[model samples]
Target: MKKPLMITSLALLAGTFLTSALPDRFIRDQFKKAEAQTELMLAQVAEATKTQPVGKPALVSPRTLTDAGELHMVPARDWTSGFFPGQLWYLYEFTGRKEWADLARQFTARLESEKMNAGTHDMGFKLYCSYGNGYRLTNDPAYKDILIQAARTLSKRYKPKAGIIRSWDHNTAKWLCPVIIDNMMNLELLFAATRFTGDSTFYKIAVSHAQTTLKNHFRPDNSSYHVVDYDTLTGRVIKKNTHQGFNDESAWSRGQAWGLYGYTLCYRETKNPQFLKQAEAIARFMLNHKNMPADLVPYYDYDAPGIPNETRDVSAASVMASALYELSTYVPKSNYRAKADAVMASLAKTYTSPVGQNRGFLLLHSTGAKTFERDVPLIYADYYYLEALLRARK
Candidate 1:
């Protein structure tokens, strides 16, 4: 019995060693693959640039491929416009390569005009992801000015009565004051704006929006509603709708990811216990869901009718993994890092594109919505996957 116990202990120690070693190996391989794929993507971008009409801001940045297998690009006004540049920024951060920084700067410069486009609430998604990463890496004074201006434009959508930034102007017929859980993500811009300019109004607005979302957007179980319509005049709730979920009551996977990331950042920026508690609760709701797959990537909607047949959203997993890595630092005793590792490993092993496929995107099978961009390689998916890898490296 003593001899058997000694052998068992040795086996357990070996297993732990292998487990700890896997992530380092995985991270290195993924970065190598990412660099190769990014090179292919850059070639594609260069070809696309040649076709751009003169004197217009070229939409050369890759967003995703269309269903027909052709590359799709969009102008800076598109919500997804910033992610490709953000990926370039991540590559620069990972490699410390001057070439990557030069490419990132070129692509990032295309979106500078979006700083004044206040018609939508995606200022953070558009500016922060592009210029925000650039600013972080370079501290370019011009980048700081653009970010501050973008924050000011984003602030224009904040209604004091509703206590939330309005998410859309096009859907006004359906909602008087629509505030999606995604709006939580845009708050980071406001917080950073305050940090850059020492303006408390941005900080106050961000806290107000976060507090309002915490109070109204979450279900009893901490799962979030996709959209919460507010009475702009009365500061009252009108309805809770799920624009991208299986149903109004179902948990949209990416929405949950957004909530988790948003609250985690909110806590980091403000050190508010409520935000931390909310972040933990959201994390619990996601990780403990019965529908969460063994691979740690969730279905497009947790309550989608297909269950085992439902499409997995790699984008959501990527975002969740990135957020969890940061969240783990805040709550070191929690299982967030382990869970993040599981997700990253799964993504690297099964969900990543081949060395030169999927139009050079790093990730695959990300659903943009239940009805649109299903099972495609989204640029944001790749961006967040790179972000998670960086966080893991740290």
Candidate 2:
């Protein structure tokens, strides 16, 4: 009888611990709240479009990206243009509502021309976020063609000798060939293109880029710098710095998120052990950072001189939550799920909008760039916030 009572007590204590660590009810409710906020955004966009000319056959460039506390509209060709449609597609996925589906189709259709825009490395963000979801959910034949074309266009930017996709086309005084850590993300589209078309060209290019980035982008401590400049003529690394971070050596929060998310995702598609190990290292560095907040959200930059006084990046948190969810699946001994759940719960409870406000954005307190542009809502923040919720739901 005594032994049985002790076992029962231990079981009860374990249950309590897990309850404290996980917030299932809160995340479930957050999912519903996200769906509701998206519904309101649809109606608001419709009204805004009546005067804004974001009508039929127009690109997916409705108003988003907060500047001066107002969400400004970007051209459809803008790097961020895909997220608005991508959000609508996510809403449709969550609700199974025909209205959301109609809206998603309308917005996604406008970005078709991006398939041929060969100058930018962000074609993945613009195409995969919009058409990738469409292809995944609906199997729309047209989405397939668009994605393949976009992949081909993106491939044009790859510098074979440098073994990386040049991130920006406009020449800069800083470097001739700039390869950002963010460009690692675009490899997913190339992989997808290879799978869709049975063309080994896309697959080889992606693997090469990953290898080059893995060799050059990270530090001994595993925290990554934002940009690696290469000599285009000689394929040699010129400099490493954080263009968007506080300084060259300071670990930028979103840049770290991109490394974690990109490598985790790379491992998933390729099952490459190197990618897996790299993702885990980044995860450990981020989770074990002394300056990380109790809530698991981080300051805009880990080495920012302000420390606790610096603005917290909700965007980075959302990205981390979503990335950690996937990373948790790959490793056997990883405690990443607990941390992931806690971060999502924090975002849902503290950072999220209870007023259903912030121009229909979900999470707040996101810093765009540390150039005194602190505490602003961003379209990518909302997009990844919904994405993290969906991954958590599953």
Candidate 3:
């Protein structure tokens, strides 16, 4: 009788322990909802893209037409052609559909053939999603070579004197050599290229740029500025200003996100304590800001004081969410994980379109190149949004 009673107690104890070890049902439910949402989004994409003409997916807009009877989609003006295949890739992963893979392959081929001869600040978007992802998914050497080539080309743009990659080749002599916070996120492909090719030069340039940014871009409180001009000859930071934000000292939401993720990547790749510390500082600044909304998505600028003028950028939330998840590994297991999980949950619930169909070719609300247009869906937003989802699932 005593033995049987002891066995029963042990069984009860084991059952309780196992139950407690399981993930919270609430979190699991959020993932389920996200999965359902992704499925729905795929359906919508299929419905929308199915009717359109399919030969290499012509870049078209209602406003533009070329003399060659083709819709003229400007290069820098359109930053999302590379992200178009991501929706297809997501569908392929979920549904195991060959058509989706084929479409992804076709998109990758098109991007490779087109090349980045045009001047743009975002080769990472052009190559990472299309070629980097294709190489990861299909193990195609062709895609890998394209990525390697793209990285090599971008690496050439790195100005040793400035210790950072140039942002744009503008008509004005003022911005002939500029560095933007956004370049931090785009430099990962270069790092990856270094890893793949065993070329320290790529990593050297990438790390130098990040180190330069750490010195110049960071504010007193760890918030970041958007753009900084450098002396093309002296490697000196000339000016720091908010090209897209409310003012020079204002905190741009996406810039904060970029710092959070970029520094985290720097830490991961190089294990530099400074990078980790910077990442945490930026994360804390973002987390503690009074201006951010409850959903974790932030206005274009945290310093923007008005109501109607304030605009929430879902892209920032997505990038931060992904960065925080990576950051959790380095941080002690505590509220940080919960914080990261909660941010991801909000992104999955609030920003994710119903059934995942995006009308603007974006998963989140990103104010595209604010200098050019007031607000539009930018391609990198979709790229980062998908990257966060993938990282969260992993």
Candidate 4:
């Protein structure tokens, strides 16, 4: 009996060693697959470009695929419009290919006009992912200008009384002034704006928003609510809601990822220990949750009713993997890198789209929301997958 138990222990140890040792090879293989898929995407984009009206700027950047197996492209105003170009930038960063840089530049140019679009709180998701990466890679002064302008535009959504940025202007009937946990991501743009211009106003606004969110958005267990509506006139909490989760109280998987990534960035920018602690707490909550699948990809909602039968969200996994990679750098004593590697490996092995299929998207099985975009490929999933791969390589 003792010999058999020892053999089982050895087998488990060997399995751990094998899984731990595979990330380098996995990153290479995944990038190779991504390159092939992106090549097909370039051709599709060219074909789509040809059909644009003579005077119109082509708004045909790929977002996802339709239920009929056709590609779904969106305009620059779309929140996800920046991700494909960001993926191209990551490809260039990884492979050092001049062609990828040229293509990235071309696609990134399409979103320059979003600098003045203040309709949404996704300036970071749109402009920062596109122009921010572009500026980081090339030190392009024009990209810097666009990022600064976009940050200024995003600041327009800030409600001083609420001490938070309003997330949705269109949901006026449902929310007086809603601040979503996802808004934590856009604070990165403001932080960058301060760095670019030496203006502390952007920094202060970002800090205020983060502090306010820290006070209001989190559960005692560190799982976050998706949305917190406030009284903009007096900075009072009106209600808390999980607009996209299973219930008003359930944790939305992607929203959790957003908070994890967002708070990590806040700590990076502000060097605030509270933000770092929040990030670690969120990581622990996610990793230690009983419902977390062995592959590390989470269901669309952590508390959704259909546990084993629920849809998996690869996008959330990708975002969390990317955040974990960055967080690992900040807290080298933690197990974040290993966990990130596990998630990335799972995604590489199980979540990637088949070669030259899924309309050239690199990942599959992401749920954009409870009802919409269920079990489909998402552009941001590929974006963060490429990002996590790059971070892993570093």
Candidate 5:
């Protein structure tokens, strides 16, 4: 009787220790380590980009210096334009370098003139990352103006019939106004615009769009379809297609990441219970999948099932890492923070290449889509990876 009682007590104590005592200290230590790593990484990047030539202004601007002492520009027109200004924003924050500030301003001006338009569903990436960071770092009103104009243009894509923002406009079509998982990310601009302009209209529209997605796009288990079409006249889901995934019903890894992150952002902005719940569900579904690589990066789709030649997406890892960090802040008791921290450490240690100035790209294996020639080291991966690092810094 005594021995059995002692064993029961020990089991109870162990449960208490794990369920309460261990996690607080563990989270603190995890944050401390992540902060230290961010400091080192920032120092390394600053040293590398410090003496290198800015190089001639290419339509595709050169972003980083090579390992061989050569200046190599990351191409323009990629989703990474958002990140370049952001990197400069960090440089300004770290070193207080006026050059970084000036360069950021110059780039914002260039990108605003070139890319701001209605057809872009990526205003958050294109504007928030560049102009938003510009305003945050330097307090330039011009950046704010650029953002406002971009917001108005993006808001124009809102379809009253579908109550969702349309993502693409191909040459053959006239505002064929469809929604993709990727659009969740772009809606942040509207949400941010609402904050800036004191306009609830943008906020309302954004929420309606998100609710539409919640109702139509996500599966019973909270796994998401990549693309869902809507009938313009009747506002009904026309079809679900796997534009980037393996099949209509298949889970596209990055799409899942986007929904997880985007819904969380929406919840953060609105405190909407549904968005938060959806984020949690999607996060669980994404983390539980067997197809995810051990390092926490995922192949383009979970059901890329039999494609031995299927490629992994470092972008998915980066986006999910950012989402995990945000979700960690929002849902503290879920142990989601632990998972996020682990993913961050894995991304920093494993996927990061040591070849050129931290590889001039944070993530190595990203698949853009079949149409964009597939499985490339995408700029958006670099963007989100850096954004995650910055979030940890904050």
Candidate 6:
């Protein structure tokens, strides 16, 4: 449902022992399990490629859970196109295998052009997740250029009047300029751009967007609305609505996860106390909710009308886990670390695929959208799950 962030908070390790909730053995075992599971899926994707009626590699499918339960991948241009490649990079980071590196390179190659595509706000998701991680691990000069290009493209979408990056180009009739909570997650690319080139333009854009998002995207409870429509001509707020959540008024599980993770990252990048406060408020709303599942994996929407029966979104849980782990670093007074650990624990215990199931994915029961794919295993879920694991011990 969303994308990258973090290592861990030193504040967390310095404050208290997280071992009670996330033990060393559990972390090692999950990686071991992930390695075996990932290898299986890699082979499965390769084999599936062999049978394609078209004469291309297997990475061309949507990489989404289909009606037939196949691990079909989409084109390199798809919104989710970067995830599977990004996953391969994570595999390389975790396992230290050259084969993973080779495959990661090949998959990352597929998205090379997206760095210049400004059609959407997710260049951060597309290029940053794959090449950003690649540049971090490899420091390839070529990869560095790609990351800069993508950051520049993403910056093009920023509306100076609104002080926010535009989320979508096609929703003009409904929103003069729609700014979604997910855009906050993309600011990392801008921050990276500034760091690489010493260009304050990128940094300024990132801070401005975050500040505007803080002003308009949240509510009294700090549970975020998915989209905030702004009058582009005057930069005025017009309406707030949810496109992926159950209803405009409900707190979508994944949307909240985006806000928590996004603001936590904002605080990390800027050391701004306001961002930390925003992140903490979001954390409290979700944690103190009456309907939050005991395991910490929330329902598709907190107020989706059907409680106890609504599908659990492991994707949201994975995201919240990763975010909480980072948020814990900034706030020593809260039990965010324990909550993050428990979410990962539940995923490993309940949501993980059996040895030969889930099309070789790790976590399961992640809802992609309401009334569709209620219990599918999504690639982003697997990405964040691994991320949370890596964060657990860092």
Off by over 4 Å in 2: 1-25, 51-59, 62-68
lDDT by residue (104-167, candidate 5, tens digit) is: 6766665775345666677887778788888887777777777877888888888888888887
TM-score of each: 0.94, 0.91, 0.79, 0.94, 0.79, 0.91
Local distance difference test, each candidate: 0.88, 0.80, 0.66, 0.87, 0.68, 0.82
Clashes of 4: 0
Give the alpha carbon lDDT tens digit for every residue of 1-394 in model 3. 0001121211222123221321454334434444564444444444544456555554322112123322224322344556656545654564476876886776556566434544665777666756777777788887777777888778778888878888877735666578889888777788888988998988998899999999999889998989898888998777777887778899988888988998999899999999999999998899888887765667778888683467677677777877887897898653445565666555544454433333324344455434532333444555566566556555
The order of the candidates by lDDT, greatest first, is 1, 4, 6, 2, 5, 3
Pairs that collide, model 3: 40-355, 41-355, 41-356, 41-357
Q: Where does model 4 exceed 4 Å of error?
A: 1-23, 53-58
The candidate that wins on lDDT is 1
Clash pairs detected, candidate 5? 62-73, 356-359
lDDT of 4 by residue, 17-39 (tens): 22353346656777887899999
**Full-model lDDT, candidate 6:** 0.82
Error of 3 at 274 (Å): 1.4
Give stretches of model 1 more than 4 Å off: 1-22, 53-57
Q: Which stretches of candidate 6 lie over 4 Å from their true place?
A: 1-21, 50-62
Angstrom error of the Cα, residue 202, model 6: value is: 1.0
Candidate closer to the true structure by TM-score (higher is better), 3 or 6? 6
Q: What lDDT does candidate 1 reach at residue 90?
A: 91
Q: Among all windows of ten consecutive residues in candidate 1, which has the lowest summed lDDT?
A: 1-10
lDDT of 5 at 201: 83
lDDT string, candidate 1, 1-394, tens digits? 0001121211222123223523565677778889999999988777766787668666757888887877788778899999999999999998899999999999999999899998989999888999999999999999999999999999999999989899988766898888999999899999999999999999999999999999999999999999999998999999999999899999999999999999999999999999999999999999999999977899999999999999889999999999998998999888888788778777765677766666688888889888898888889999999999999889
lDDT assessment of candidate 5: 0.68
Error of 2 at 22 (Å): 5.4
Error of 5 at 105 (Å): 2.0
